[model samples]
Target: MSLSSSVEFPARFSYACFRLTPHSVYAINATILPQKCRLSTILTAPSFDELFPDALVNPSRPSDLHSDPFWAPTLSVDLSDASGIWIHLGKAPAAQCDKLLINVYKEYSNDSSRVSFLETLEVKCPETAVKWENQRAGKYLLTAYVPIRGCKFLCDSADKHCRQCLRTHLSLEIRENRASFIWLALHTMKDHSYEIFIISAVLVGLIMLVMCMGMVYALWKQRRDAKRVQEIQLTMYVKAMLIYADDCVEHRNCMRMLVECLRHCATCEPVFDMEKLLQPDSVIPSRWLIDQIATLPKFIIVISECGSRILDTTESRTHHLVQARPFADLFGPAMEMIIRDATHNLIASKRKYCIVRLPYSPEVPANLAVLNFPVFNLPDQFGQLTAFLHDFENIDQLNISQPLSQSRMTSFREAVRLQMTFFEQNPDWLDTRWRPIDEPAIPQIREQRLPVEISTDEDRIAAAKLYGIDPPRADSEDEETGVGPSNERQFMLHPPANEPDSDTDDDDLSTSEDEIDDEDEEGGEMHTVVFRPDNLF
Candidate 1:
């Protein structure tokens, strides 16, 4: 479409200009009024309010003189920090920051006064290029740091805040892309924002201080409670017992030996045979076990790798001489005791029962596998068993505990002799007689005297007395060769390692007690009793 205009009026001089671009011909009209309008109406000025009503978002801080109406808040800042304050300007279409300007006003009543010259404080805008990554992540613009260090000029010392603050106004400007002059923009302004920030900062500071005090008090209380609980746990009169599968021969033997260790070496007095605790009329073995468990404060349950199989054994213990109730019948009560104890903390606030895994049986039984008082892994946390028992007695007393005395050693030997007698009772248990593999029935190898043979009657009596067993009588085997059943433990001593095997056919090459004694005196090597298989029949 073409138009012949007879009137000579400059389109730029009239506010009501009528025109449209090539794309706008069908979609838009650049002008707002009809073409047949009068010159008065065409030349009339347009109200900035009518053009952009929402442009004055904040009336107190209007756009700067050269700023576009739409580009109202071109400057942004975080004035909360008093020490280091910075003023930022939005990037131009060309992304140029060379013509940037910043000013700090001391006391400007309203924001419209920055246009003219005023008393400006000395400020520095350090030009630094920001990396593209930081610009994107931080939503950064053309950054010109107006380093308002200290901000001393903005101080109102009356109400102390952020080392005393005074509100100051700042403005920023950049070279305009389309317009001939540079664009001026005021910083984003809000009244009492600093006041709110100061108030919030004070409140936060108080809250943090109170929280720190509360944490300190809580820690102190926890430590005090723990100390009190420990004191309650340790006492002078601590009666503890040892428990294990009665069907497990290894467990029974370990417990029998452990009783002596506890009596002499350990801090607490160990109770092994609970049969004495049974009532005269009580027939149920479970009841006796339950009663013992209920009355006892501390218990050491011996669990070996094969303990699970022991629990599963329907028959009585294989090699043990003494038998009362089936192990299966007795273990149920013990399991019940474990379950009841683990469900809740004790009055002292810690688990009392300990699962003892000796070196012989390192693995824990499946029934006692997942205990709150867990079976500590071997070589690592295994000492918790002894630690628990130690808790039963006075810690100071345990620290000053002395080794077993001579009399106590005699008692220990007595206990060990009882175990040895029990070991010898099971005839099938000990394979002392060795026969040739080929010859089913050959002449038996006569038992040789011990390396330190029973030589004198007094030595025999002393040895018997040392083991807490009765000495043999004068008419018995005690006088013949001073070798008898009373001092049988010494017979378990291993012969010399280099001594020939007695399977040969030579009687002159026999070893007598005198020769053995001479050989023992000659060689300084110790004659250890081989300690007899730990009472394990």
Candidate 2:
């Protein structure tokens, strides 16, 4: 039999082994000697009923303690020639038996099973005794009953001391070879630690994944809303200027679709190409054609292959000018001159042309491609053309937007059919007999020397007389009556208060009052002038 129990040190130590014993002769003691086995504690001796509590034998009913694994006891013997028995207990702590008391029993009379009290011993165990170096795993034998050899004060009665020491040894080694409960608990905790770590890492990874997805979705939504707002604004600013074939035979399908698309726009106006109107049978004066070209704002021009061919035809060219007769009649030659000047200004600078190239024709002339005029190669669909004209600037310049609405497409097709019918019935309406021949090309003249350099005063007098204004004399008494010296001889002349200028009913001057002149005065101020018949001189 062996006495055993376990103690756990804090985590600083990897593993520790110890041997302990009681010092006094009157005390029972248990010691942990070094061994090669798992760490365990030794259990002290007790009656069979106390050791296996569930298997107690009753006189009325028999019980079997040998059948159960927990109640069974195995014994081993040591080959060493020692007089005392060897009690091996696994790595039990020495401190379990500290101040523990035990009683030894003896059998008497004829009943061998009966027992009586033999001796009572107090066990005095130390906190720590023998410490081992290695953590070797094997069994260990703890000789629980080691008798004290020398006793100074108690040795006066040698016989009494001998008997007491024998009795204490008997009490100490009553139990043998027990296991430690603490080692089992330590193994169980280590197993659960790995599972806990894995569970926590998985939870954290899932949370990060969800956050990333939400961030991406929010960014995508914000950009979508911004694009929608731009679409609405672009649609409102859309205006179309259509140039189509009048023949109604070639490209009739495309031409009708073009008209339908143009009608859907807030403003759809026809523009007559100057090249087309330079035909023999043309009735439109050059001035009428010029006025129509000058009043244009930001406009989209859709040209089909057939319409392009029509402009290059003599018959169609003549028809365009004749159709423009009504415009010339209403605005007259004066308005026509204003238009001619504006067109000439645009043609000279060639900076403000806004031309869009259709996907229908790649052979369109390079002359049509002017500065700052973007070219788009659109798809053949009408609805796509409408959407492209709406937001062409804000869209990706490389690709065309194809948001085809079926309803708009159907309506446009129907509108084109009606337009073709009107054109067929009114074929001769624009073909009036007022055909005018083209004017001769402007004659170039060599620069001639003037007999005398015209003085500033002479320029002022000439301009004043041309506008029928009697300019204030330089020797005038009132400074207000005379033109400022800085403004003298400028292209523009303000009417004098003393003499009312003749009213010139020219269309050129009618709309030119607000036109700012680029010519600067000597004082660096811009001269705001209306174009009168004198400016043409």
Candidate 3:
């Protein structure tokens, strides 16, 4: 029987068969073969030399039908030694192909050559069936078959062999497919990473926004609190100014009080709005002097002994006294009318111009004037002054009306009486008593002597040194000696004293005196007179 013959074997039976060649051996099991055997002698088995002309056959090999053949079959295949095969499926086939049944084998030459059944799979050429002719020595084999009606193939007793299994059998065939799946997984991871980054950025922005809002709120609250404090301070400042104005008006010395108020107002560093108290058209006028005086309801005038002398002086007796008339002229007429009219009006109407006689001096006006109207010793004047400053403190309360329960007038009278008795007993007090205002205006008489003309150079030098001037040296003395410079000569000028003796030459004085006599001399009285003790007593 030839190796290519078909053999049939009975079911479940075991058999053994043998064949022999010049340099080969083959063993067969009859029971394992097909039941019918077809022995077609039309083709003869080729000699090992005929099958492979280049092969070197061993001559000492056995030649027996039962003995091992020169060619052997290896049942196992080593994929590690096998060359890989590749297959391509274009797009998708229009129709499925017939079932591909293949018998695979692994062959190994004694020379360590590797051959695989998978290599004969026709991976490059599709739609073809694969078959094996015979077994060879040093060869491994496997069988692969595609089952009809299934999406997979069967191989090596495995029921399912899909494209994934094809890769295990032939790694080269599915290289691109494996790489495609790897790239897809990487793309998915990239997308997930980007999403995570965006979410993190949004979260950070939200946190920053919350922080900024908190800061803004804090600043706004701080500003609101500061504004509230400023408003309270301003209100307090206004109230303080009002109180100071009232206090200033209550004191009878309105001008001095006004000056104090102005000083206090200037001391306030951050100036407050005192426009209401100082406005030109307001109840309190703008001028510092006018405001204090006009705001006081009433005031008293105190005249001292010195004031009386200034009013009583005559130009004829003491020429120096003539200088005082200008001062008297400034205030005299106004004082007389105010005192006379206001006193008369008050006495006739029985109105409260409560006059308490205090010692008076001529220089000081005995009457107080407001808008050219007099207010003379009015008891209600004290009451009015107190009412003006009821809201203020630190004022001269003595000048204002005392409470009815406390008699300020009686106390004042008793104190005056005591002082008068003391002055009567001690005459020295009268000498030191308040002098007339004219005393201040008296021209101090300096002793006069005829000035010696400094015609000599020595006199000029001495005069220069005495007056803190550069001395005329001997060199310049010759140019100007008799006529000295006007400034230097001033040190030598002195008015003549008693050269025209007035007591000895009365006629000489009368002629000059009548021409220059003061206006008061016509009436034989001074318009403003200082009442001496003789006139008063």
Candidate 4:
């Protein structure tokens, strides 16, 4: 039958029915015919129910009549060309097609009849022939029909064919033209999620960076403060060492270490050059010693008594070395003379010079007097030693002869006066002078000339005046006691014999008392008194 022909099928349609299995279904329905048709026409009609079934039919009623007016109306003109339609069915329904023929027609009158009906039967029963001929051909062909200009249908027994067909068509459409929209949606979601991730990552990184920077800065500041403290401590230690270098020659190691610390300190802070302190050619040691003493710092000289004795021996050697040099000329005359006298006294008396003692004691032995001048102490001694060094250092520039000519004599006399003054001020020193017993007395000598032959009164007067006495008198009370004007001047002015010679004896006793009084006034006591007589022949 031509696919486009509308046909009416007999209501007495019948066919061998097959049971529906779980995988298949069967559909049978009816529709009102709009035209008269013959049996041949029924045979020639396309499978209209398969091709165009109303989708509103109840799903539970596989065989119920579809009575809704919409279902009863003649199928509308085929819309296959305007909207493509597909149908699907499973196996079991095709074997029951003969009992389920349906009539499909259009609602139109003959007044406008331009259509013609023609019938011709052609059976494409290849599957039926193979089944009957072989009886073992298990594969079966379900019938399918399609109007030339209408929808397609399958006559298999599957009940979900329509849904399957619709699903397949939708899948095809999605695959063909909607792919870009789906991809765009997916990319947008990914972009949003990525943006959030990046923002979070950046925030976390910034926070960590800030924390790390803060930690680094704090550590740097701590180290800086520690370094500053160390520098201050080092500077103070060096200053202390410098001050102690005086009077503590054993602290040379401490001073050297302090200098080393100062060198290191200068690396981290502002300090003077420390290398100058250690220069071999410099007088830094001596200068530093002087400076240390000037600062009023004390050095502890820990001398055991035994050590003191050894030091004394060493000091003697040092003095001998000092004296053997010509540097004494650099000292003032007073100091020079005193040093010379002290040396002479030491040699003559075979006594140790107290000045040569190492570690001068505050009080010396009574026999060994300490010079009370400042120059006798260690500081002044060092000053003199340094002065000698200065002179030695500039020996070429000194004019020895010029100083001797201009000031040496005056300085020598002044030095004598100084010694006298020192002795006078300290009588204890003079009292210690050694004296000898049996000291020889001064002799009295007589004039060899004939006692000036005082034969005249002028001569007698001259002799009396020369001797610091009164002139002899003749016939005076002086002659009544057998006193004579003799050439001997002693008896000439003798006390009157009548006075019992008490004046002469008393005068001699008074002179001896005056001598003793004078000795007492000079701050010395005579251990023994000696008598001397002025005698006459």
Q: Which is the leading candidate under lDDT?
A: 1
List pairs with backbone clashes in candidate 4. 15-99, 90-157, 90-158
In terms of TM-score, which candidate is stronger, 3 or 4? 3
> Using lDDT as the measure, what is the rank order of every candidate, best first?
1, 2, 3, 4
Worst 10 contiguous positions by lDDT, candidate 1: 131-140
What overall lDDT goes with each candidate model?
Answer: 0.42, 0.38, 0.33, 0.31
**Candidate 3, RMSD to the unseen true structure:** 34.0
Best by TM-score: 1
lDDT of 4 by residue, 203-253 (tens): 999999999999999989877764553211212322221211021222223
TM-score result, candidate 2: 0.25
Q: How accurate is candidate 1 locally (lDDT)?
A: 0.42
Clash number for each model: 1, 16, 35, 3
Candidate 1: stretches off by over 4 Å: 1-235, 247-251, 274-284, 310-329, 344-350, 374-386, 390-537
lDDT of 3 by residue, 1-537 (tens): 123234354223243332324222122223224656422111112343422222224545444534212221112111111122212121112223333333444544443246555444432235432323222222333433333342344345464453211111211111111224455567556758888789888999999999999999988976676455321121222111211111111121332332233233322111112434335554522343233333432323333332343233342133221321111221233234335656666542222121222322122332242223222222224333332223233233323333222354454344445544554676664343323435654553666553544656566655544433333333332236656443332221112431233232445434433432454466543322121211111
lDDT of 2: 0.38
TM-score of structure candidate 1: 0.30
